[model samples]
Target: MSKSQGYDERLAVPLRWWAQGTMLVATLWLTVVVAVPGPTAWVVTGVALALLALLLWSYGDARVVVRDGWFQAGRARIEAEYVGEVAALDAEQTRLVAGRDADARAYLLLRPYLHRAVKVEVVDPADPTPYWLVSSRHPEALADALTALPKTR
Candidate 1:
């Protein structure tokens, strides 16, 4: 949980077909080493595999799910008991970005393919923070869902 002003946000791991393709390629590359000879092949293969795993883990986990009265983000499902407020941020609206990101930050998750996102606000005296900036695929839908959730005390 990070803090700043009067909002809090939780993120999830980003998963998409492109990323899956990368994972597949990495896996295949590692498998190819089996055809190589010598101990050096094994060593190089191990290193390559390790690097690939790290890359997958890095991008495989970058999503944000917000809930009020609860805390759920990433892989862990959070109950809606510790959440505060809901916030919607998009590049088209925020204009707080560069590149093609300007018109696409209006979805559920950020992507090179689609550029939008939403975040949960954490506004408790006990948890004083500003807001979380997240990327999303369905900006309006995510915002609507978050806003529709019942407010918490």
Candidate 2:
């Protein structure tokens, strides 16, 4: 069975268009920041640019891969052997986890802009980590795919 999740191209196309449309916005801001050049402004501008880059990468690289019996998200990949359970989580639930762990990270495949999410229990015995909380706009599909996978021993 084929299983995977990704951002809506229709939804993301506009986002990319908007990002590209606003590309020139950076140059203008940089010019203003440079012309009035101050230490604080420079720092702020630098930070803003970094944030833009991160946002772009986060959206551009957003995807979920569940093929050949594998689940891939960002830089991590898992197989059924390493997956325990797949459950849907909304904004409230996600916030709960976010509040607890300072270093917690989730590879969101759906709702880049939404507050809802999904948590998957990875069954990897090699690692102590129990599960991953991923933000997904299409939580039901994600859960279904994950739940259908055969657990690996």
Candidate 3:
């Protein structure tokens, strides 16, 4: 089967979050430079930089893509035929699905920082997973793509 992309997006950490994290790292470095003795301050800064780099690296790879009749969120991919009831959720609803009323059997690709998300019901009876809750910066678009899977297939 020919693979074609229907919707592709990375739920990137917002720019403001990057800015805030950078500022926080700088603050920690400055605090260390002022209070800590010896070369420990520079060591602390290096460790902080390493941690920041690791954080950005991991966050950068997470993506949501609809292609080849499949929907991928983070590390999980499900065929479009098994995806149903695509719901675009606002911040409050997203939080509720991801937190308070969350199901243990549901697959979640959530980013707590991203307020918007899409909930897709899984129709495969053999699969124990009931649904997938995924973070999306463009929830409506993601939901639309998911709902339109039948046409794409």
Candidate 4:
């Protein structure tokens, strides 16, 4: 929730993911130290840890926002005028929509950690994408915000 009148959510990776990544880096440090037994091992471990941090930070930086009559997920955005029906999906429904019943042309902003999602139909005649399936921790809130958008068209 920013100062703007809209919904904003950051899809940050879970703490467990960071813990697991740190453990993996620690294991690599141990293995390297055992094999090389010098400053070279320390340097290698430092590099590995830095790279892991960079990767996790970038991967978890995706954002979903509904503001100023627009819906944005990651790098894609659509005006409210072109937004159609919106639905908040539970874990089971999200699985089905993202897997079994998924459209090839649909825009997807899925995350393995987030089981729930919001499905928003694209009403624009010019767009090839049929809809957007975006993973959200608060799918219901996201759906409500999207549904409340003022469709000027």
Task: Identify the candidate with maximal TM-score.
Answer: 4
lDDT of 4: 0.94
lDDT for 78 (candidate 4): 98
lDDT (tens digit, per residue) of candidate 1 on 1-153:
212111233333445654775676667656665677567666766676677667656765655554443343444343443344655666664446433433332222344544565555545445434344456666565566555555544
For model 2, the stretches where C-alpha displacement exceeds 4 angstroms are 1-59, 101-112
List model 2 lDDT by residue over 37-60, tens digit each. Answer: 767666766777677667665565
The lDDT of each candidate is 0.50, 0.63, 0.85, 0.94
Candidate 1 segments whose C-alpha is farther than 4 A from its true place: 1-39, 66-71, 75-87, 92-114
- The C-alpha local distance difference test score for the whole of candidate 3 amounts to 0.85
Q: Which ten residues in a row have the lowest lDDT in candidate 2?
A: 5-14
- Which 10-residue span in candidate 3 carries the lowest summed lDDT? 1-10
**How large is the C-alpha RMSD of every model relative to the true structure?**
8.7, 6.5, 3.4, 1.6
lDDT for 83 in candidate 2 is: 80
Per-residue alpha-carbon lDDT of model 4 for 1-153, expressed as tens digits? Answer: 433478999999999999999999999999999999999999999999999999999888999999999999999999999999999999999999999999999999999999999999999999999999999999988988898888898
> What is the C-alpha local distance difference test score of candidate 2?
0.63
Ranking by TM-score: 4, 3, 2, 1
Error of 1 at 103 (Å): 21
Report the error of model 3 at residue 46, Å.
2.5
TM-score for each prediction? 0.50, 0.62, 0.83, 0.96
User: Which of the two candidates, 1 or 2, achieves a greater lDDT against the reference?
Assistant: 2
